[model samples]
Target chain A: MNEKPLELIHGEIDGRISATEREELRALLDADPKLREIRSELQKLAESFEKVQPLDPPAGLRARILTAIRPPEKPAGLAGWFPAWPMPTALRYGGAVAFGAAAAVVALQLGGVGQGTPGMDVTGLAGTMARYQEPGPAGDISAIQLNLNELHGTITSHLGEGLVILDIDLTTTRPVAIVADYDSGRLRFSGYAQTDDSAMSVTNNDHQIIVNHEGPQHYAVFFEGDAKDSVEINFRFVADGQQLHEETLKIPLVN
Target chain B: MDTDNELELVRRCQKGDGHAFEVLVGRYEKPIFNVAFRMLGNYDDAADVAQVAFMKAFENLARYNPAYKFYSWIYRIAINEAIDQLNRRKRNTELDEARLPDWHTPEQAVRDTQLSAVMQEALMDVKTDYRTVIVLKHFMDCSYEEISGILDIPVKTVKSRLFTARQLLKDRLADTGLL
Candidate 1:
C-alpha cells in the first residue's frame, strides 16, 4: 500500500480533512500503529477540550433579562378594560398644553357632558372633570381601571416626537410602573418590576418614560422627539405598597 | 424540531416576537454555552458572555441571512464576544498572569479531575489567534471551511494556525512531562 499522508491523517483527526481525504486517512489509520498513536494523542486532547462544563449564570441574570424584555401587567380596576385611546396627532405633537386645550375644545364640542350609569354615576361636566381628577373616587370610572382577569394587551400613544407603546402579556403577573418625562424635546422613559421578591428596573431618560415591573411580565415603551424641546404628561396608578402601575401622557404645546 | 420548523422560529423571532426568540434560546443555549465555556476558561464569564451574545444576536436578527447556518452565525457571535471580553479584560488589567499556571504533565492531567480543565488552562495561555483556531478545530469540531467562514480567514491561514497551535500545545505538554 502507498504510504499515507501524515498531513491528511492529522486533518482527519482534527476534523479538517475533506470527505475523500477522510476516507483515505481512515484506511491508513486502520493499517498503521504509529499513525494511530499520534491520532489517539490528538483525540485525547480534543476530547478533554470539549468536556469542560459551563458555569451557571448568576441567579438573577435570567430574571433580570426577562424583566427587561417582558411586558407589564395592566393596572387593576376599570382602566384595565378600557381600550387604550390613541392620543390625537395634534396632542402628541403640539405639546401637552396644546393637546389639553384641544381636548377641552373637543370635549366641549362633544357636548362636554357626563352621563351616568347604574354601576357608577358619570354625569355633569363637573362630574366628568371630577372623574378625570379622582379617576375612580366613586368607583364609577371602571373604564380606566385595568382588569386583572386578562393580563395580555398593549398600550400605545405618541409621546413627544416619537410613539410610546407598552405590551403587557405574560404568564406571570408583575406590577409595572412607566413614567414618561417630555420636559425637553427628548423623551425619557423608565420601567421597573419585581419578580420572586427581586426588583428590577430599566430607564431611558431620553425618552422620559420609566418601565418598572416585577415577575415574568412583558412590556415596551417608546419615545421620539427632537432634543431640547419639552412636553408634560400625567401618570396615575395605585400599588399595594409593593408595586406601582402608572402611565404618563405628554401633551405638547406651542409657546 | 425540524430544520424547516427552526427556520420558521427564526423568522418569527426576527419579526420581534420575544416568545419565538425565547424558543430559539432554549434550543441552542446548551450548545452555544458549551462553545463559549470551552473557548473561555471561566464558567461564570463564559455564561455571561454567552447570554450577552445571544441577546445581541437576537437584537440584530434582522441582519442575519437565512441562507447561512444559524448555528454558525450564533457561534461566530459568541466567539467574537468572548474575544472582545478577553481584550477588554486585558485592557482593564483584569487578566492576571499569576492565574495561568505552567503547562501540566499529560499523566498528571489524566489523573486529575478532568483533562479538559488542564487543556483549557493550556489553551488559555496561547495567543488569541492560535487559541481560536484550536478551539474551532478541536472543541467545536468545526471543519476548516466552516472555521474559515466563521472567522473570515482563508483556509490556508486556518491550516497554518491550527498546525502552530497544535505544535505549541504539544511542546508545552511534553515540557511539563504530561505528553
Candidate 2:
C-alpha cells in the first residue's frame, strides 16, 4: 500500500533490485499479503506486454523513403548547373541567402537599409542592399539581429562543402515563421534542421526555405552555394500570419 | 549493429552515402515502427510516423552527434513524433473507437486477448508521458537507465513514471475484469 513497497515490487519485477534491496523487499512482502497479491497482478501485466509482438514494417517502406531523399537529378542540358529541389510551387515559401559570388561582395542589407523584396505569396524575393564590400570566408554572409519584440536572436551564415548555412537561433513567445529567400540561380536548398528536437516544420524549394515553430530554437538552413556573379539572401520573419521583419546577409565570390 | 558499426554508417550517411543510410534504416525501421504502433494503436499512423522520423533523421545526419548511440537518437525522434501525433489527434478531436469502445462484454474480452485485450486499451488510457515510459520499459525491453536516456529524463523520474504507469494500467484492467 505504501509507495516504498510498490516501488520495491516494480524494481523486483524489473530485475533492477540489489541483493540487499531484494532482501528488504522480501521481508516487507512477507509481512503484507496485499503486497504479494499486488505483485502477482503486476507480473500478469508484464506478461501481457511480453506476449504482444512487434509489428513488421510494411514492405518497400525503405525504398520509398530512400527515393524521397535521393540526390536530385539534374535536368538534361544543364551540365554545369543542377536544378535540385524543385518543390511544390503551391508552397512557394520564401527563399533567403546571400552567398556564392565571384568576389568579396559585402552587400550587408540589414532590414530598413533598403527594403529587400519579401518572399512569394505572390511577389518574388526583391530587396535592395548596400554595395558589396566585406570579405568573408568561402563567400559566407551574416545579418543583423531580428527586431521583433516577441522574437529575439541573431542570424549568421557559415559556409563549407559548397553549402552556405544560415544559423538562426531565436527564443519567442508567439509562433513565428522564418522565411529564407536565396538566389535560385546561385544556390539550391540543401537541408534544414533544428539544433535540438523541437516542434518545427520546413517548406523549401531550390530558392527558398520557410521554417515554422515556436519557443527557443537553433535552426540551420543549408544551400549548395554555386553563384559566379552576385546573389542575395533575404530572411523574412512572419508572425500571426503576417510579415513582421526582413533582413539580408550574403557573401559573393568575385573570383 | 555495434556502436562502432552504427557510427561508421552514420558517418557515411553524413557524407551523403545512400547505401549506408539504407543499412541504418533496415536496422531501425521495425523497432521504430513498433514503438509508434504501440503509442498510436494504429498501423497506418505508425507507418507514416516511422517513415517521417527516418526522413527527418536522414535530412539531419550532419547534425547527428556520434557520441550518442544511433538507436538512442532515432528512438527519441520516434517517441517525439508519436507524442506529437497524439497531441494533434487530441486537437482535431479524432477519436479511435477501438481505443475507447463505449461497450464491452466478457465475450469480447475473451475474443480479444493480449494485443486486443484490456492491457492494450489500458495502455492508451494513461497519459502520454506515462504510456511512453511503459512502452519503453515493457514493449521495448529498456532498463530504467535506458528509458531515462531515450526520454531525456532523470533515472529517478523514469522509475517514478514506470511505477505509476504500471499501477494505472493494472487498475484499468481490474476495472474491466481482465486483471
Candidate 3:
C-alpha cells in the first residue's frame, strides 16, 4: 500500500530491483492480498501493452524524411543561384544565439537608420548596412542566410528592450510569401518596413506574411515587435501555387 | 543494429550520405511511430509526428551528441514533439475521441479490436508524464535506465512513475471490465 513497496514491486517487474529489494517486495505481496491483486492487475495491464503491435509508419515516410533532410540541389539558371538552404538553419532555440534575440540585436544595430520607403515596404542599402552592422549592446548580432530558391538573402536580427528587429534582404524574380511563426503567444507584429521598392504589396496577418513581386528585384523587409518573444519563422516561398522552398528559423528573444 | 554500426551510419550521414540516413530511418521508423501512436492514440497524427521527428533529427544532426545511444536521442525528440502536440490539442480543445480509427472485423475480431482500442483510449487519459514511462517500459521494451536516460530523469523517478502509471491504467481498465 505504501509508495515504497509499490515502487519495489514495479522495479521487480521491470527487473531493476536488487535481490534484497526483490525479497522485500515478495514478503510485502505475501502479507497483503490487496497489494497482490493490484500487482496482478498491473502485470496484466503491462502485458496488454506488450501484446499490442507496433504499427508500421505510413508508407514512404522514410522517403519523405529523406527528401526533407537531403540537401537541396542547386537550381538551374537564376533559380539555381538562390537554392534552398546552404545548410540546415543553425539557430539555437534557447542559447546565446537564440533566433528572436539575435534578430532584435540586428534591429538595435540598425537604430532607425534604415526606414522603408513610404507606400512600399522595402528598406534600402542603408537599412542593409544597419542590418549587418556592428553588434549592439546585446554583445553580438546574429545573422541567418535565407537560401530558398528565387528568394535568396540574409537576415540580421537581435533582441533588446522587449523588441525584436528583423532585417531581411530577399531577392526573387517571382511572387513569394514569407511567414514568421512565433511561439511566445505574446508576439505582436507592431511595425514593418522594407527597402526593396519592388515589393508590390506586403501584408501581415498575425504571424504570416505575403510579399508579391513582379520582376527580378532585391527587396529588404524590416520587422519590429514591441514584445520580446522567441519564435520560429517558417519562411515558405510559394510561386505558381507550388512551394518552392521551406526553412524553419528559430528566434530567441530577451525579455 | 549495433551501436557501432549506427554510429558509422550517422557518420556517413554527417558526410552528406542521404542513403545512410534512409537506412537509419528504415531501422527505427516503426518503433518511433509506435511510440507516438501509443502516446497520442491516433495513427495519422503518429505518422506526422514520426516524420517530423526524423526530419528534426536530420536537421539537428550536427547537434547530436555521440555520447548517447542514437535511438535514445531520436526518441527524446519524438517524445518532445508528441508532448508538444498534446499541449496544442489541449489548448485548441481538439481532443476528439471520435477521431479514433475503426478496426474492421468479424464479431469476435471486432470485439478484440474494440478491446484494444479501449486500452489505447485509457492510455490517452493518463497524464503525459506517466504515460511516457509506461510507453517506454511496456511498448518500447526499454530498460528503466534507458527510460531515465531518454527522459533525462533519475532512475528512481522512472520506477516511481512507472508504478503509478501502471496503477492508473489498471484502475481504468478495471472500471471498464477490460481486465
Among these predictions, the greatest lDDT belongs to 2
- lDDT string, candidate 2, B64-153, tens digits: 888788888898899998888677568645233322343222323444455555566677889999999998888888888888989989
What are the C-alpha RMSDs, in order, of all predicted structures? 19.6, 16.4, 15.8
In terms of lDDT, the poorest run of 10 residues in model 2 chain A is A96-105
Alpha carbon lDDT at A199, candidate 2: 42
Over 4 Å off in model 1, which ranges? A1-6, A15-40, A50-61, A71-255, B94-112, B176-178
User: Candidate 1: global Cα-lDDT?
Assistant: 0.50
Residue lDDT tens for model 3, B131-171: 99888888888888999999999998997788778889889
By DockQ thresholds, what CAPRI class is model 1? incorrect
The fnat score for candidate 3 comes to: 0.61
Name the better of 1 and 2 by lDDT.
2
| TM-score, first chain, each model | 0.24, 0.44, 0.39
Candidate 1's error at B21, in angstroms?
Answer: 0.6
| Candidate 2 residue lDDT tens string, A1-255 | 468888888988898889999999999989999989999999988887877766666443554344334444433322112113222221111111111110001111112212333322211212111011112333335455765787987777655435565667788778777777777767755444344445444555435666554788765655665676546788788887678888887655443
TM-score of each: 0.50, 0.56, 0.57
- By lDDT rank, best first, the candidates go 2, 3, 1
Q: Write the per-residue lDDT of candidate 3 for residues A150-234, one digit (tens) a residue.
A: 7777666654323455656566767665545543244544323333333233444445544554445443333344344456666
